[model samples]
Target: MPQFDSDPVFCSLLQGSSDSRGSFSIDMMDYSHSEQSYIRNSPVLVTVLHDKYGNSAQITDFAPRFKQYGRVFCPVMTIRQIKPLNGSPRICVRLRPIYEYGAAIPQITHGSNHVRYVGPDMILRLTTNYSINAILDEIPVVLDEGVTLILGPDETVPDSVTEVGQQFLNQTLDYWHDWTRSLAIPYEWQQEVIRAAITLKLNAFEDTGAIIAAMTTSIPESPDSGRNWDYRYCWLRDGYFVVSTLNRLGTTQTMEKYIRYLINISANSENNFLWPVYRINGMRNMEEQIVESLAGYRSMGPVRVGNQAAEQIQNDVYGDAILATAHVFFDERLEKPGDEVLFRILENLGEKAIEVYDKPDAGPWEFRATKRVHTYSSVMCWAACDRLARIAHHLGLDNRYEYWNSQAKDMHKLIYERSWNEKLNSFVGSFDGNELDASLLLLNELDFLEKNDPKFASTVDAIGEHLKEGNFLFRYIAKDDFGEPEYAFTICTFWYIDALTSLGRKQEARELFEELLSCANHLGLMSEHINPEDREMWGNYPQTYSMVGIINSAIRLSTSWSDAL
Candidate 1:
């Protein structure tokens, strides 16, 4: 429940030049090893610093995570190791951590070799093998040998800093190596796929099986566009994409856990009406409010804490939940396969989908004011009944299969009658509406239309003509509650790429995918939006939808290892 953002530790070298005031000038060091790589392909970060003199030092940082007693143990502790490689390096540690959203300053207390920061809700202890006085007073110290720092809850570590740090590092490295070995990664772009896979895993909340949409809040879609929204909670639509993409990579544990989360949400629903989003703890209420205390990202103001879209009716989530759950029923690798009781719970959701398939709702874009019968929402509604029929047939329930199959066929016929725009030679965004949206590109992927269908091909070409900006595809060009959107929603481009490949445009899809990969940051991570004019990343960081797009595209486009051999 406590939310805040601040760097925990700051260090400065003490050998910089001095000004006339007798203070050392703050000279920015030229960084050489800028790649965000881990230690031996593990989660730990290692960095080396060398002075113009012969002195060099190494800094390794990691959060301890390993297996214990046949179960994973990942504590909320971070360990840092600093060792002298040559000569002696001088540095100062500025240990500062603000609490209560930068409002409360923690009171510091220290013993012989540790410092404690007591705040309102929690206390953090910093145990170090270096000089306690030097750390507490922020004084300069010489690094002549290796030292370790451990920061965690206010409790004794029960081991020496160096010993515990080394043990945890070794265990964590082994954990990651074991995990990567189990993955069926693509032959090409193996490193990028691995990094993206790790990022998707990091976004998942292990305790609840709820994966957040992104880490930060209020990052604008474009400069001064007032398009910011908090993304620190779970959305069922986004969760489906994450789990399904991971399933394609032969990583099923994440999907298995996420299926439990979806079942919990669906089974507990009152009147079988499911919300589009929820808190990470499976709570229903997420009231949107602006925090007046802090300036927004880049001073955009109106820093929102919760999302208002949770209150809106999105019919597509019914299908999203069922699609996510269907995997558990089909995948034989899971320890707990979907049972009859679980199918009954999902059947209620399918019934709800039948009631809302042709009705108006917010749609996937979550427009604040407008409500329309979106073609994509109807497609998903059809998918819910379609998938249920398949699940029923797979379970040997002939009566239920026939029932759901009939419902799906009726919905499909109605969607085609109302959504197909003959004048434009494509299906529009809404029923009987004339606007093209990027989501309509999913017609083929959702099985609403086949790849060889002329309407599907025309719809793909139509969306590209209207919404595509160079390689990036805008969600739509039409005006919304926040006026016209100014930046490209990153995942829409991936959907477009998939559609192209399905249409036998492999070379073009490959080129666009490679160009889109170049748009990721140096660490191979993407946000929610990208500015087309300047190619700058915008919106929340490490977005789940964007990262899922990377994995799916790579899997579809990468050459097989057998082909290379």
Candidate 2:
């Protein structure tokens, strides 16, 4: 069972009481009053609810994050404030915390002003301004005034509840304002870009410079499709897109730290082989497992914990790892720029890319039971060498540059010869395979082919003819290990939009991009997959890949600020 199966906190109105139990009920809103909004552009959420009895309350929730001293201080604490707006709102607070994946219940203890739940491995302390006995005994309490709850590490809060909560909220709002001011957002869709940027920032694990694929696990791509997988760990390929997108927006700090993550992982590779995914702390191994005790999202079984992709042989990871690190060499904003040592480490990985550019392996899709010389993987291998040559030239290493350039030229010639089909007049998914895939649309973006290249336009046309479904694009129509995908992958639509824009189909691209933008949830957030017909998001929550698509598309399609003004 998942630890979250047990409701951690349930604070509701109190109507009646029995032996050691409280009955909670709220009258239906006869007047139908409720409002929800955010604090400016920040992540703070405030919801006001009103009942038919003229009882109203405002609930504010946010995670504390701000700059303290000279460094960013984002504690693991979350603050929730409940204040009465009208009438006497009597309520009860129920606190139940479980540990170890719902296998063990923690022992509860309380002090004068706080409650602590002690477990074997961790301790959670909840400091609130409510009555300690009322919460501990599950008794009813009067909500005549505002109440604050701070959940964090077991340590005591030094300041009073009201002072601490208000102070943190103000600071967090200011922090987001300052962060937003630094972004060079597009003239149009400024709010969308900012929201997507903040979402990407929240996905980043700053402690280790690893950005997670998503915050959720086992939220199946489609209902009961058995396609669920855990995405809590970091995929090198996803992180590359994330940092690259952020880099384009002039956010170099995230790119620099991700480069450090790449460097550390590459240095730790004893055999010069990189895993597709890793724990946020840089651990290379993640043993995938299923928790049968808890029902998955929508009562689907088999909630997964870790990811098995870490052990898979996905060759595209080499190119992704290098691509993420290449930014460190060219970006002058970085405090410690890439040096000769880092260049050499990348060269070792480039050598690996050269060895496996054409070999059969699990492609970028990571087919569980199939191995093919995927066109995307080979092109990425080509990219690894291609960027290395550029970096060598930047460092004034003539001989080294010549060597890498020669290698890239040879690989490029071989890839085009093997991957392109004369009959289709386009590049296929895998070498000699006649299927079209959305990834092939990135040929121009990757510089594998020039935008004016006739073959590139033909390839884009072929993809649009076959893979395009209304406003959405499928990753591929061909059946994989899980059979044909029922829903469209969110990022692929963005890629298609980008290809259309590059092909001078600005009107078409803009129309499709607007349709895709409507796919995001009410909070301007998106998931991994969406139903094209209904626009319902289905995969993992707040996917980094999907968020990257929003940022990149907005940047590509928006008019220049100078021209617009």
Candidate 3:
């Protein structure tokens, strides 16, 4: 029903169409392969253009098609568009790169490197490796008749400088097929798992190992309105889960790259104070700025470019980074080199944690106006100390053992005593107040309490009563002055699955896991949150935290299911 006046180049590449219910249906087979898996499998961006009779045209294209948008040039491989026979005012377009030399070409190829379609009110143009001059050449052709032109490069392209793109494509597919087939887990949920895995991989910027929180920036929390923020940078808290999830899925190489990214970022700290987050290229200063000129997604006002929270002292990051590194060391059987710089970094973190452990700072949520001694932050501090102590004991760093052990014990005691609210029968958000936080679920996962403990049960029950909405969970209760509460956080829902699994609620955990998996978009991507009423994704897209949650929950569910059998 809704339509665009003309299709933008970005929207003409989507591969699917919405049914009468407005539910988008996409075909995975047309877009999937292991080596090119992450790139080819993304949802085609779609835009609809309308004519005088209200007839709409659907435009779709892969993001890589916009290679000109980047400074580099790649080959154009494949681009195609389809329209409904009934003329429902929508056209479906799918674009991919041809990597294999002998691959079958559709009749639509039309024997030219570029293609153009002209209708009464709309003109569609798609070009590959066609010179920027050529692309620019066609713009006037469409605009002269008031027609719109959509254009971009195709994916899986070979290098424009070298003709090996076909060879690379073949090799990539072979590697992906072999690697995916080697997984120990059964593929009953293979389609979903592969889709999720590809989504996670795509979020990783290939040029830099730094994983972005999402691809697009400034998709508003409310409809074309408030709560716009950029998620293109790396959040240290997400690192632990992202690496852990990839490792669980048997993608050690990808996990290793992320570890390298971690090492690169962590090694840059000038003093004991490392940033809570960083830019994709390891830049420290991400001064938040509004892009006043461009209209945001759906006319969301004030398109933002940089993240302001990079400077904020989010205390949980210290623990999260250490915990993630420790998991990598443990899971990958990595030999601890006494001389590795990361070890020294851990030691420095331990020393810093001791100084700042008692201080009130921004917790995991990084609330703008308020700084509080958040319980989750303290719990993570305990976790950092615990990890450092264990690693030291394992590596025979006997000299540092006593100090770390003492600190860990002290933090554990403080969190248990001060962070718990006996009056509410739940763990409060911060030591200064009694508001329950969903993050307390981490207590069980951290093994701070036994699964069957009365306190743990009560805490879970309290969260279920207060925070759980249907199958999804909220991060925390709404605070009016803090910020807008937009949608249910995707990562929080996965955290719930993790917590439920730890508590031996295996059936409940699996059921919830399946339900959450259903929340993924057509390309198996997830945003930071989900709109409860409409089920549309909100917040950042292809969130690393959300994908990490999915992989972790899947592994947990599979392991538990196997043990029960």
lDDT of 2 by residue, 1-565 (tens): 1121112222111111211111112222344577877777788988777766877878888988999998888887778888888887666666666554444567888888999988777788989998889877877666889889887878889989989999999999999998888888998888888889888888887677888898777788988898888887789999999999998888887887788888899888977898899888888666877765446666764667687788888888889998888988898888898888889999999999999999988887788898899999999999999999999999999999999999999999999999999999999999999999899988899899999999999999999898878888889999988899899999999999999899899889999989999888778899999987888999888899998998898898999988998
Instruction: Give the candidate order by descending TM-score.
Output: 2, 1, 3
lDDT of 1: 0.82
Q: Each model's C-alpha lDDT?
A: 0.82, 0.83, 0.61
Q: How many steric clashes between backbone atoms does each model show?
A: 0, 0, 16
Residue runs of model 3 more than 4 Å from their true location after superposition: 1-168, 182-188, 332-341, 480-484, 559-565
Give TM-scores for every candidate, taking all chains together and pairing residue i with residue i. Answer: 0.92, 0.93, 0.74
Model 3 lDDT tens row, 270-357? 7767677787777677788775434555555566667778878878877877777776545644443333356677878767776676
TM-score of 3: 0.74
lDDT of 1 by residue, 1-565 (tens): 2221221221011111221111111111332232234665566777677666656677788877889998888887888888877677766666766554444567999998799988788788889898989877767777878889888889897988889989999999898888877888989888778888888887887767888898777778887787878888899999988998888888898888888888788768899899999887787777887765445665665667689998999999999999988887799988898887889999999999999999999999999899999988899999999999999999999999999999999999999989999999999999999999899888888889999999999999999888999889999999998899999999999999999989999899999999999999867889999988888999988899999888888888888899978
Please name the candidate that would achieve the greatest lDDT relative to the true structure: 2
lDDT of 2: 0.83
Count residue pairs with overlapping backbones in model 3: 16
